[model samples]
Target: MAATVEAVIAALRVTLEEAQKSREASWKVEAVNRWIGQLPGSWSGRWRRLVLKSDASGNARRDELVAHVRAVIAFLETNRQQIAQSRKWWPLRRRWPANSPIANAPVAAPASSSARPVNLLRVRKPMPGIH
Candidate 1:
């Protein structure tokens, strides 16, 4: 019975590791998808069909995950080069200026009462005639 319990624990550990890897892979795929979607019109669709088609299988094997990530990186690099070469693609790189009012707005401070500073070292005076 002890051997069986140990074996079960080991199996659960393996299962947990696999689940974590699967989740990490899924997150990577989603991130790549988001970047691809940000590309100019029809480019995202074309790239998705060409580069990320294999990811539709829903398999999270490590090799498959690496392949998907590599494909996405390659696609992004190529697209970036193309965008740099084309004058019409400048809009893709244009971001709102950092100095904008919304971006410069100060964060709100935490709410607190406006109280006088406490003096921890102050001695209390003895009450008159109370001795």
Candidate 2:
């Protein structure tokens, strides 16, 4: 009777462990499904390649990379219209502050300003009417 009871208890424990494991696996699959659904088509090929590579090593880093890429892609897609509109519009013009000395610096005068003008009105008398 004791042996039978122990066997039954062990069986129940095994079944419970199996159930928990299945639940965990189901959750993982669900998460994966959600990710795949939300991911953009452009990134699918790259992500699929990374997943295939990582599957052999069982490392989930590649999956994390895929998730990051998917998030960035989704963000860009959502904001694309806004970005386009912003590009079409000119950026706000910022007026220079009146108190900013750099903005009020004296501009250098052109070099021509320093040179004397030609004396066009000078009377050139030929030396003692020698002309």
TM-score of each: 0.32, 0.25
lDDT of 2 by residue, 1-131 (tens): 23332333344344334444452322232223333333233136423331212234343343443454355345445654553344212224545676788778999986767677868779575798676
What TM-score does model 2 achieve against the real structure? 0.25
> Model 1, range 18-84, lDDT digits (tens) per residue?
5456645443344334434444432544343632333465444555655655554454445554544
Among all windows of ten consecutive residues in candidate 1, which has the lowest summed lDDT? 1-10
RMSD of each: 18.8, 25.1
- Candidate with maximal lDDT: 1
What shift in Å separates residue 113 of candidate 1 from its native position after superposition? 80
Error of 2 at 113 (Å): 13
Model 1 clashing residue pairs (backbone) = none
Pairing residues by index, what is the TM-score of model 1? 0.32
Q: On a 0 to 100 scale, what is the lDDT of residue 79 in model 1?
A: 59
Give all candidates' CA lDDT scores.
Answer: 0.48, 0.41
